[model samples]
Target: MDFAIGGMAAVCAGFFTNPLEVIKTRMQLQGELQKKNKQNIRYKNILHAGYQIVRHDGVLALQKGIVPALWVQLIMNGCRLGFYDYGLSRGYCNDKYGNVVFYKSVIVSGCGGVVGHYLSNPFYLIKTQLQSESAKAIAVGHQHHHKGTWKALSHIYFKEGVSTLAVIACAYVE
Candidate 1:
């Protein structure tokens, strides 16, 4: 029940923030001087990213990858919050009188969040790629070329191999 409620709340908020996520990804991808050492900034900041995304790609573009993002959020938050709750119930994360032990709670919550992140990494990867593909530097960009999430995952696993599972390792520090 706690997990479901938390997931529901997260889903509701996610609908509103998903567009910002798209804008953020695009913005992060922009202004990179990685190879040539020459900055080519397309968005000045959040406002500009929002404006440019709608102006150039239409308002619908803001919702790109939202489905996967929601799945990522739902599963991630559900698992994170749910497992935290589970730890409390199991007596591993709370004091004898039921007060949460700060360090234990943090460790439990972090473990749960990492579990969620690991499970959602593939979807998050797809979300990131779909959201950032529209960046101006397509020529050198490594954005997934697949048209759908399934294809993207399939391609990543087949071509990228164990590197795909390495996503879980990245989640450990989160």
Candidate 2:
């Protein structure tokens, strides 16, 4: 029940925020690895990003990685929230009434988030790549074009390396 509810909530939230995620990823991956040429940025700000994406790539551009994003969010948030609820129920981290203790909950939630994020790291990577990889966006000098989520993971693993995945997973938090 908890997993189901958590999954549903994650799906909703993922869909709602996917465009922001896409914009954020594009922002991060914009400006080449060299000294960032701020003058050459395609998407200036969040609003401008939204407008340009819709205008250039259509409305669906904002939802580029909708599949992988939703999957990652569903799995990550479900596991993290599930673990949190389990900890609270077991009185392991939260107060007796399941109210969160600030530090304890942070620790617990962070641990859960790390594990959950790790589990979904491949898809997360795919999501970032999907959002960032236009004809112009070259990630870390890699030029291989990816087809989809699994392909992106495979490209990162077989072509790139798993260390990349580690960085992505560890960077995320609750």
Candidate 3:
């Protein structure tokens, strides 16, 4: 179905981009909230960051959050493409004359994306948390010691409660 195709495509894309994502996350967290001069620049730039991560944590480190990242992409894209297709089939993205309406299509696609994003927020949160983890010497941001994706999800649900997840997702939206 459209959902499966979309999800598979997203998973493929996520696999290729995950390393870059890992680098980006570490770079962003390296001197987070710190003033320019006061910040310790562990990751000089993208290449350096990638090098440092691999050197410290091994090649696999570049895929630190692959599991959750793939899950996020899969679920989000699946729902998004599926919903968009559904809307198209229902004529929600077409004018009365049966012509495709640009604005209507945009609205339907946006709605699908929003729904997908909302549904995948938890996986995204886990991905971010997991990706931020690194060897202490090269670690950046708040290092959450999540054993894995499922464990992280359970920890959040049991210890922090569902409301915590909602709040985090809402904060990202704003």
TM for every model, in the order presented, reads 0.82, 0.74, 0.94
Estimate, for each residue in 1-174, the C-alpha lDDT of model 3 and write its tens digit.
788999999999999999999999888776673555545778988999999999999999999999999999998999889888888999999999999899988898888788788878888999999998999888776689999999999999999999998987776555
Q: Model 1, 33-66: lDDT tens per residue?
A: 4445544566778998878877777788788887
lDDT of 2 by residue, 102-153 (tens): 8886777677777787888778767777776554432223434668887778
Q: Lowest lDDT 10-mer window, candidate 2?
A: 135-144
The 10-residue segment with the lowest total lDDT in model 3:
30-39
Give residue 30's lDDT in candidate 1 (0 to 100). Answer: 60
Q: lDDT of candidate 3?
A: 0.88
TM-score computed on alpha carbons, candidate 2: 0.74
Error of 3 at 111 (Å): 0.8
Q: What's the lDDT for residue 94 in model 1?
A: 85
lDDT score of residue 135 within candidate 2: 46
CA deviation > 4 Å runs, candidate 1: 34-39, 135-140, 167-174
Error of 2 at 22 (Å): 1.4
Which candidate tops TM-score? 3
- The best candidate by lDDT is 3
